[model samples]
Target: MPSLELDRYLGTWYQLAAVPQFFNLVCARDTMATYALDPQGNVSVRNRCTTWMGTPNEISGTATVNDRVTGAQLHVSFPGVPTQESLEGPTNYIVTALGDDYSWALVTDPSRLSGFVLSRTPALNEAQWQQIRTAIEAAGQSQCMYLTSPTTGGLSGIAPLCTV
Candidate 1:
């Protein structure tokens, strides 16, 4: 996760899989996150998803690069959501692994409480799935904790990383 180039990482990333976060449990499918460079030198984050009732749910936040050296760690804070935003406390999102072409990435936090498999496209081939699984394991994450996130334009099966 060293030498993470933020410029290359800035873009819309589809959530192929993830460990559920309490606030996002309402989402039924099609989870997505978008990132854009802000004038404040922070990353603008916008997350969207489809709820079980077929409604769109979204939240915008600001992500500060917490790790100045590697730029892999970030502290994200939503407008009204209660979470730490201080640069020195703890990073809520960390790019633990990334694809060679930046097409996919594995992300988590210091506590490893949550994990996400993000890809440039909604769907991936078997080989890409395998790559994500390998990265998850290499990051010391439990595949059992990660479930495939069903997207309207991507994979729908609610399977575990171990089964992928």
Candidate 2:
């Protein structure tokens, strides 16, 4: 499969849903991620969230587009963390589908090992949901887990359903 276009993929994007990371454990109200061009032209990330204590938490990181044409892989590092390490190895950001106006996007790893549904806004439409679902299936990641993002207008009452 081809990769996503890097330039078009850059910019601030709201996290619709993710696999749930340790850093976001205290997120209670809202969580957002912003991507911008860094000084070296790499991708800079700023992740913000409202903590359970009602305090704001923000982390800064940087990302490098692995493949220019495919924009499929990236290596992210948190400068604030010890040793400035990355959470994961070079992960693939396979572009599954994109919104007509580039308002939303569905991306997965090359192996379909992980996935995320991102949008310009916190919420997405039914059409967008279906599109993501289709993309997930197409990527052979139907067994992957789906997270509950209450801050993004998703259900928080129940646990996520893992197909695997």
Candidate 3:
């Protein structure tokens, strides 16, 4: 696993593609997530997306670093959500791949059932997209077929190769 520089990783990230989650099913476009380092060293997470009804939906959560040495594993929890009691352990979120300049990242859970391709901008270049796809495969996840391309109006209107 690669180590993550918390400072560099903190900021707004657009979701270029992701395996569909029930909670995000309502999202139609402009999906994004933001991370901020809290005073206590924990990370505050805020996710937002344009809903199918043309409204914005947002959720706030918190993530704690599970391994200081690597800083790639995280235990994330949304308020009032029973993530801790779920079958998967709390440390499910991991930074599987990170761009050298903190421009993009690939994140997945321990079960490989959840994954996200995130970028600093709404779209990634051809080379960046290729790198992210390769990283997703390397992470042992095959459900890329379920990834939905967010329409943030930045990629020359190119459709995602994956089928939703």
List the global CA lDDT of all models: 0.88, 0.68, 0.79
lDDT minimum window of 10 residues, candidate 3: 155-164
Better of 2 and 3 by TM-score: 3
Q: Which ranges in model 2 have alpha carbons more than 4 Å from their true place?
A: 1-3, 80-89, 92-96, 110-113, 152-164
lDDT order, best first, reads 1, 3, 2
Please name the candidate that would achieve the greatest lDDT relative to the true structure: 1
Candidate 3 residue lDDT tens string, 1-164 = 65889899999998888777788888888889999988877888899988889999999888888878999999887876665433224687899998888899989988988888888988778888777777887888764444655666654232444432
Scored by Cα lDDT, where does model 2 land?
0.68
Candidate 1 residue 101 C-alpha distance from true site, Å: 0.4
**Candidate 1 segments whose C-alpha is farther than 4 A from its true place:** 84-88
Tell me each candidate's TM-score.
0.94, 0.77, 0.88
Q: Model 1 over residues 1-164: C-alpha lDDT tens digits?
A: 87799999999999989998897888888999999999888899999999999999999888998889999998888877666444335688999999889999999999888999999999988888888888888888888899888987788878876777
Model 1 Cα shift for residue 3 (angstroms): 1.4
Q: Write the per-residue lDDT of candidate 2 for residues 1-164, one digit (tens) a residue.
A: 36565677777776666655566678775677788888888888888877889899999988777666766667678865764476455654556778767788766766665666677777777777777767666667662465645554644432452421
Q: How much is 64 displaced in model 3, in angstroms?
A: 0.2
